[model samples]
Target: MVEEVERRKKEILKAIIHEHIFTAEPVGSRTLAKSYELGVSSATIRNEMSDLEELGYLEQPYTSAGRIPSDKAYRFYVDTLINDRENLNLELIKLLNNFNYERQGIQQIMSNMAKMLSSVTRYTSVVSEPQMKKSRIKQIQLIPVEGKRILIVLITNTGIVHNKIVKLKQDLNPRQLGYLNEYLFNNLKDKRIKGINNLVLQELEKRLIKRLDLSQEIIELVYKGLEMVSKEDDFKIYLGGTSYILEQPEFNDLDNLKKVLNILDHEEMLKDLLVTIPNKELEVMIGHENKIEEMKKCSLVFASYTVGDMASGKIGVIGPTRMEYSRVIASVNTVAELMGKIISELSG
Candidate 1:
C-alpha cells in the first residue's frame, strides 16, 4: 500500500531526497532548511524527518545525525516526483544527430548508440540488437551465381534484408530461377519467422521436388536457405561503460564491488536485468526492486524502441541507487525515440 503524505511532509521529503542525491551523503534538516524554501523551521523539518524514518521512508546511516532516503522513498519519488516527459536535453539531440545512420550497419549502429547513452548519462548503458523473429517475410528471391552457386535474398517487413549463398549440384537457368522465386514468395510471404519450421520445409520440398524435377542437392540447399533467413539472433546485449558503475560510492566496498562487476560481466544476466515495460512507458527499477542479487544496490531504467509498432529491443541505464532519475529518464526516452525513427527510415 502506498502511504499518503500531507503537502508539508511531501515538500520536506522531496527536499531531503534531492539533497541526498546531490551530495551522496545523509541529508540533515539544517541543510534542507537553509537550501530549500520549505517554509518550515529546522525543528519542524527534523520532526518530519523523524516521522519519515519511522514510516520507513528514510534511514539514519551508522549513527549519523543526517538521514538518507530508503528504497521506499526512492520508489515513491520515482512514482510521483519525477516527470516522464521532462524538458529535452539539447546536447542529447545534437549527439544523436551525429550518428551516421546511412553508413553504419546494424551492429555498428547499436554499438554507437550504447556508447552514446553511457556517455550522456554517465552510467553503464546496455542495448539489445533489433529482433527480426517477429518480422514477417515480405519476399524471397533466388538468383543464380557463377557455377552451381545460388544466392538467396530474404526481405522482411522491418526493412532487414538477409543474403545467403549456397552451391547446388545443377545450375539453374533464368526460367527456373523465376519459377522458384515466385514459388517461395507465394508460399512464404507475410509468414513470421516462427512459421518457417521443419514441417514447413518438408511441405515445400515435397511440392518443389515433384514440380521442378529438382535434384536432392537443390532441395536440401533450399531448406538451408529458408532456415538461414528465419534464424533469430535476438536479445544480444551490448554494453557501454561497464566500469562506470564502479565510480558510484555505493560500490566502494571491495566485496560488494566485486559482486557488482561480476553481474556486469555476464551478458545473459544483464539481459535479465533490463526488462522493458509495456505500453511504451519508461520502466524504473529502484534498489531492492531488482530480482538479481548483485543488482539490489543499483537502479535501472529501461525504454523500449519500436519497429513498425512492435517492441524490437530495449535501451537501459545502470547506476547506483543515488541516480538522477529525472536526467536519466529524459536521456533514455529521447534516445529510444530517435533509434526507433532511424530504424523505420532505414528499413524503408
Candidate 2:
C-alpha cells in the first residue's frame, strides 16, 4: 500500500512539473486527473497534492488552490525524474555537422555556437572564448608588410589566432627576414603563451646576442612582437539571443526583465558566473541558488567544452527558474559535446 501511494505521488508531481513548464500556471488536481491518467480520482490527486505541498515539493501560489513545483521540486525533477529520458535534438546535431568547421576561426565557432544554441533552445545563450593562459603556442609567423613594419601571427594549440603589427627600429632584407622568421619558429615553438614573459625573452636574447647575423634591434623587435601576441586581454564573452529572455513569462515584470538585462550586459560578471562551474559536467543553478543578485531569479544550465585537453570554454543557456529543465539540459549537453569535438578538430 505504501509503495502504491509513493508511485501515485511521483506521477502527480511529475505531471504538475510538466504542466507548469508548458502553461506557466499553477496545476490543480482536476487538471492533472483529467489531462494525465493518474488512475486516481480528483479527490485522491488533491490529497496527494496536499501531501506534496506539505512535503515542500509543491506550493500554492497567490491563494490559488492549484499548485506549482517549488525549487525543491525542480531540484528533484532535475536530479531524479529527468533520468536518461531526454534525447539530443537530432536536427541540431545534423545542422552542427554541416557547419564548415575548417574555415571558421575560434571566435566564429563560439559565436555560431551561441547563436545555434539560442535558436534551438529559445533561451539566451552565452559562450566564453577559450582562456589563453591554458593554451600552448602551436605556430608563429612573422610576415613583413613594408620596410620596418611586420605582421606577427600567432596561433595557439587551442585554435585561437592572434595578429599584431610591430614597427622595428631597422629594416631587414629578404634573407635576413627569412632567417629571423625561421629562428623565431624554431625557438618559440610549443611554448606556453603565459610562460613567455620578459625574463624568458631576455634569456633568449642573451643566447642569440653573440650571433653576428642577428642584430640586437631585430631581436628586441621580435621580443616586442611576441609580447604583443601574448598581451591580449583574458577572453571575451559572446552572447546571443538576448531578446529571447523577454519572451519568458517570468520576465514579464518590468523590474525582473531589467535585472536580467543588466546582468547580461555585465560581461565580467557573466564570465565569472560561467567560470565558477567546477567541471565539464552539465550544471543547473536554479533561482536563489545563483549567487548573483540579478540572476537569483533565473536559472542557468551550462556545460564546458574542452580544447584539446588544455583549456575549456563554457556555453550556457539562461532562462527563468520555471525553465523546461529537461529540454534545456539536454540541449546544452549536446551542444557542449559537439563543440568540444569541433574545437578539438580545429585545434588539432
The prediction achieving the highest lDDT against the true structure is 2
lDDT value, residue 182 of candidate 1: 92
- In model 2, which range of ten residues has the least summed lDDT? 83-92
Model 1: residues with Cα > 4 Å off, grouped in runs: 1-5, 97-99, 138-186, 194-202, 209-233, 275-279
- Number of clashes in every candidate structure? 0, 0
**lDDT for 69 (candidate 2):** 88
lDDT of 2 by residue, 66-164 (tens): 988888888888888885337666767777777776788778988998999998888999887777666788888888887689898888887778888
What does the lDDT come to for candidate 2?
0.83
Which regions of candidate 2 fall more than 4 Å away from where they truly are?
Answer: 141-153, 163-184, 194-233
lDDT of each: 0.81, 0.83
lDDT of 1: 0.81
Clashing pairs in 2: none
